[model samples]
Target: MGSSHSTPVAPVEFDHHLVSALADNAAIPVPSPARQSTIDAHIHARIQAELQRLREDEATVRDEMHAALEKENLDRERALAHDQDSAASSATLLADLDQVRAKVDRFHARRDLSQLPALREARDGLVVCYKNNTSTPLDCWQQVETFRASVSELEKQHIQSLQ
Candidate 1:
């Protein structure tokens, strides 16, 4: 509940009024003893109000800081969980990769890697197409497609020979 009789103002803001009046060279009448006591009481009330406002502001900042800490803790927990998941997948992938590599090595030992002439010509054409269409590489799509078709044909031929 707020007191209707007193509208609180900070001590610094009240001093600003006094400073401006003095800077304007306004004449100030010397206060009688009764007015002096009244002025003293007013200044005391303003100081109390300023202290109260500062305390409230401090409380709000403290609450915000605590909330930010809580959020950071949650983020760290999520990151740790993600790292654990990646570690598990990485271990499984490494094992699979080793098996694939071993199979490939064995296959290479058994087969001769003869370079087919058509595959070589297709690759060369694709290279030239890329060089000529430097600024617009999409123009090399035809060359790329031709190269892919050449590769498919060669793979089919290789499979037939293996059989």
Candidate 2:
């Protein structure tokens, strides 16, 4: 029941067509050309520096690997040389042993011949003792003389061989 009074609201005018046309022709925002070049230069410099560092690291690794390979080669050569030396020494020792064996065989043959004189003397003594009707012949006496002679010869030969 109060007097109904309504203030009139102003009507807002919008240019829909103009807004639509601007939207249709709108350009995408971008950095300035100079700024873009500066950014590209910075990125290129960083990449170049990183590449140089990587190259340096690769060179160092290659050098270390080469040094290690050289050391391994040196070790292998040393081992080979040592093996060769050992083989040479072993061959010499074997040759010396063979020579000693040959000398021993010669000595044994000489000793066998040296005993023949004593054996002949003993046979003669035995015949005389049997003819005289004495006790058994002293075979050991001749054997002792022959053994001493052979031993003396062998000692001389052994000394010569040693010298």
Candidate 3:
């Protein structure tokens, strides 16, 4: 806005002086070869040490993961074995319960039989008669003999079933 002319401006006098002085007397400092090699060796040693540490850390992590996987496999095997054992034990217990229930059912069924009821009533009546002395041994002998015969018949049936 101030000047529309395209002509170049004059250079500052101090810039010319500074450039001449640097050209005549300035010296750039460079590191010695021995010092630079020592620095390079130090950097290389640090890099190698860091790489070794990382490798060790990676190996440790791999070993830990392998051990964990082995443990998990072992635990899974133990759990499966335990489950199988539990299933076998449950089956055995169920079979035993079934046998016991069948025996109870058989006992209940036998109790309901007409012969068993009559035998029980006859034996109880004979006992009462004996306790009251209302009948002589000769008088109740027939009922006692009948009860004994019925029990002997039931025992024979049981023995035949076992055979």
Candidate 4:
């Protein structure tokens, strides 16, 4: 019901006196020398301790899972082997592994390579940025993030692709 225009009008004004936060040299609060040495140390220590505990728990869980899986796999293999022993004319290693599942794992692993280029490019860009901006390492933050993201994605893909 209102008038239509090609460009919309702004409710606010854009003034010439714009201030950049980076350009502002305002004072920031800091701890004293002694405090600075220990500032956030407790938090950091707690974080490291928690990380270690989690890592240990993960390893324990992984081991238990691995053992359980292996035991399960072994049981299945033995059953299959028993069946094969009863019916099969000859025994072989291939009898233990399911060919269809193996093929699927292989196919997934092959398809998972699609992101390798992006990962490599991110790493190369990070290296180049580091070389060019040695004085300002912060410039490489984007590249670092890209690389981390790519690595994380690849890890997830690998985990999913695992047989």
Over the stretch 70-143, how does candidate 4's per-residue lDDT look in tens digits? 99999987777678574563344455566657867776766644447888888889999999998999988888
Off by over 4 Å in 2: 1-29, 85-163
**10 residues in a row with least lDDT, candidate 4:** 16-25
TM per candidate: 0.34, 0.36, 0.37, 0.34
Q: Pick by lDDT: which candidate is best?
A: 1
How much lDDT does each candidate structure score?
0.83, 0.74, 0.79, 0.78
> How well does candidate 4 match the true structure in TM-score terms?
0.34
lDDT of 3 by residue, 1-163 (tens): 6477667889867688889888776565567999899999999999999999999999999999999999999998788668978779878999999987887776667765565776677778778767766645667776778778877888787656534
What is model 4's C-alpha RMSD?
A: 29.2
The better candidate by lDDT, 2 or 4, is 4
Q: Global lDDT for candidate 3?
A: 0.79
Error of 1 at 114 (Å): 91
lDDT of 1 by residue, 1-163 (tens): 4676678876755588788888777565678999999999999999999999999999999999999999999998778658978678878999999987876775575344354677778889999999998999999998899999988986776566444
The best candidate by TM-score is: 3
TM-score of 2: 0.36
Candidate 1 vs candidate 4, lDDT winner: 1
Better of 1 and 3 by TM-score: 3
lDDT of 2 by residue, 43-141 (tens): 999999999999999999999999999999999877866897877887899999999898878766755644566545555555655556545435446
The TM-score measured for candidate 1 stands at 0.34
